[model samples]
Target: MKLRGKTCLVTGANSGIGKITAIELAKQKARVVMLCRNEEKAEKARQEIYKVSGNTDIHIILCDLSSQQQIHDAADEYRRRFTSLDILINNAGIIAGNERLETADGFELTFAVNHLAPFTLTLLLLDLLRHSEAGRIITVSSEAHRFARFDMEDLQLKHHPYSGLNAYCISKLCNIWFTRQLAALTSRSKLSVNCLHPGFVASNFGNSASAAFKALLILSQPFAISNEKGAATTLYLAGSEAPEHISGHYFKDKKIKKPSKAALNDAYAEELWEKSAALTRLELHKVSLS
Candidate 1:
C-alpha cells in the first residue's frame, strides 16, 4: 500500500519489532515519527530505516514511554508538528525481569511502560487522529494475555505475586481491553482500533529477563520466529486494504481469530474503559465525539 501522504508514529522504535515495523512503514512512504527513550539509539534506528526503505522523511522525537510527563510532552510536540495523524502504532513495550523497578511516575515498570503509557498517549492524541479520513490505532498485544485477565482489583500487581510471565500477561491483556474499548468509543467514526499478537518472536525480551529466566527464554526462543517474520501480522493489519473495514478484533496470519473469553466481554470492556479513564485521569468529555 502507498501511505505517501500519511504521518505515522511508532513508539519504542529504537530496536526489535518496533524498529522493523517502522522500516516497513517507511517503505510505503509514510512520514515516520519515532518515539523512543534513547536519542543515540533512536538516531541510529532513524538512519537504518532511511537506508532500508530509501525514504528520508523519518523523524525522531525523544520521549520515554515509561514516564507519563514525557508521554504528554511528546504528544504536545507531535500535535504541534502535524496537522493530523493517520496511523498510531502503540508498539513500545517492556518485559520486566525478576527485579521490579518503578518508573518516574511511580508505576510498576512492566505495567506503566507496556499498557498505561500507550493508553495515555492514544487518548491524548484522539482529536488529531479523528480528523483523518481513516485513522488506525494498532495495539500489539500478545497470546500471553490468555493467562492474564486484567484483575482490576489488583491492577498494580499488589495482591498478586509478581512473576515476570504473569506481569507481562496482565499488560498484554490490558492492551486488548483498551483496544476493544477504543473501538467502541470510535465506532461509526473515521477511526478503527484493533489489537493483535505478533506470535513468539526471538527478540530482546529474553535479554531483559533475569539470568535464569533469560536462559529459559533463549532456549525456547530457538523455536520462535524472527522479528521480521513476527512483523507480518502487524504490517498486514496496519497497512493492508483488507483491515480497512475491520476493527475491534484480533488477527493472526491475516485472518480474524478468537481472542480469550474475557477479551470479548462488553462488561469487561466497559469496566476497563471507565477504570482507565480514572487511572489516567483523562477528561473524556472533551474527547467525546458523540
Candidate 2:
C-alpha cells in the first residue's frame, strides 16, 4: 500500500523498534504521530527521524502508557489534531523491575502498559480508524509469550509469585489474544488487526529490567538482530499490501506464523477481552463489534 498520505500512530516511538518503524513510515511520506512518554527523548527522536527521512510531517503525543488517564488523554488529543488514522501500532512495552510494580491505576505495571494501554487506546481511536479507507492495527508481541502461564483468575499477578520475565511473557500472550478478539469484533469493518514477534532485536528494551535480566539481555545481544531488522515485520504489516486483507494472525519475519497453543484459545481471548474492558471501564455498547 502506498503510504504517501497515510496517517500512522506509533507508540513508544522514542526508541528501539518503535523509532525505526516511525522513521520508515516517515520515509514513505506517511504522516507519523509518535506517542511517547518522555518529551526530551521523543523530541530528539523526532528530529533524527526528520533528518533521516527528510519528512517533517512527524508529530508527537506525550503519553505514559502505564496510566489509563494518560492513554485516554492521548487518544483525545489525537482526535483533536488529526482527522484520519490509517494505522495504529501498539509498539510500546516494558519489562518492569524484578519486584512487582503497579501503575497509577493500581494494575500490574507490565500488564497495564503492554496490554491495557493498547486495548484502551485502540478502542478509543476506533472511530478515527474506521474513518479511513482501510485501517490497520499492528501490535508487537513476542516469542516470550510461549513461556506465559496465564491464570484467568489472577490477571494482575497479585496472588502469584512475581517474576519480571513471567509478567512480561504473560503480557505478550495477552497481546495475541487481544489481537484475535479485536480482529473478530472488527471483522465487518475495514480494519485489519494483527500481532507480530519482532525477532528479539538487540536494543535498549530491557533497561528497566532487573540487574540480572539486564545482564542477560546484554549477553544475548551478540545473537540478536538489529533495530532495522526488528522493525521490518512492522513495516511490512504497515506498508505492504500483502497483509492489508489479513487479520487476526501472528507474524514473524513478516510471515504469518502460528502463535502458542494457548494464544489460539478463543475462550481465553473472549474472557481476556471482557476482563480488559472492565478494567478500562469501556462500555461494551460503545463498541460496534458486529
Candidate 3:
C-alpha cells in the first residue's frame, strides 16, 4: 500500500507489458486509470487486474494513440476527472509491415503513436504531475534505438522506401530524445522523466508486424524473455523508491544504460521537440535549462 493515495495513468494498459505494469501498480494500491483503444479488452484486463490484485480502483478511458485529436481530448477528460498524477507509463507501440501508414493527424503511424502521442500527452499532463509529491514518467523504448539515424530532412521517411525496422528504430530513438529533454525541463522540480528498453519479451508485440517479422518472432519465442520479466523494469521505475532522483536516462533490466550517440544528440532532440510541437499544433511552455 505504498501508493495507496496516489494516482497513475498508463497508456495501452490492456495487454503485454502495459497490462502487467498496471496490475503491479494496482497491487501497490494506486488508482490505476488505463487508457486503451478497445473497451472490451480494457474491461477484461481491468477486471482481471482487480481480481488478482484485490484493488478495485482500476478505471478505463478509451483513446486510440493513432489519433492525435483523441489524445488531446482524452488528456482533457482525464485531467478533469483526476486530481493528481504520480506515474505515467507510455508503453504502447506498433511495427507496421513494409507498407507505409499514416495517422489521423497525417503523421507516420509509428512516429505518431510511438513518439508523438507521448510527447503530446506528457506535455498536456505536466501540470497534474507537477502537483504530485513524487511524479514519474516512464516510456518503454527499445534497444533497437541504436540503429536510428536522425535526419531532419526525412523525419517521416517520405523521401525513402518504407522499412518497418527503420521507422521503429527512429520512433524508439525519439522516445529517448523526448525523455532526455523532458527530464532536463523538470530538473528543478520533483518530477522524474525517464525511458527504458524492456528486453525482447515473448508477447503479442509483433502481431501487427510484417509476415517476415511475425515469423522471426515465432522462431525466437523460446529465446525471448517472459512478459512478466519485461515488465519488471517498468514496475521498478514506476513504484520503487531507489530511483527517485534519477532522471533523463535509459534503462534495461532496471539499470541505467548509455544510449547511442545519436540518441544523446541534444540538438536533434531540441529540433525534434519543436517539430513535434508544430506537427501537433500545440503551444508548449518554454523549458528552461537552469
Instruction: Return the top candidate by TM-score.
Output: 2
List model 3 lDDT by residue over 87-160, tens digit each: 89999998888888987678999999999999988888888888778888999999999987657768889888
lDDT of 1 at 119: 89
For model 2, where is the 10-residue window of minimal lDDT?
281-290
Candidate 2 residue lDDT tens string, 93-207: 9998879999878999999999999999999998888878889999999999999986898977899989999999999999999999999988888888999999989878999
Give the TM-score comparing model 1 with the true structure, all chains together.
0.95
Candidates sorted by TM-score, best first: 2, 3, 1
Score each candidate by Cα lDDT. 0.83, 0.93, 0.88
TM-score to native of every candidate shown:
0.95, 0.98, 0.96
On the 0 to 100 scale, the lDDT of residue 283 in model 3 is: 73
Please give the lDDT score for candidate 2.
Answer: 0.93
RMSD of each: 1.5, 0.9, 1.7
- C-alpha positional error of residue 227 in candidate 2 after TM-score superposition, expressed in Å: 0.3
- Winner by lDDT between candidate 3 and candidate 2: 2
| Model 3: lDDT of residue 150 | 52
Model 2 vs truth, CA RMSD? 0.9
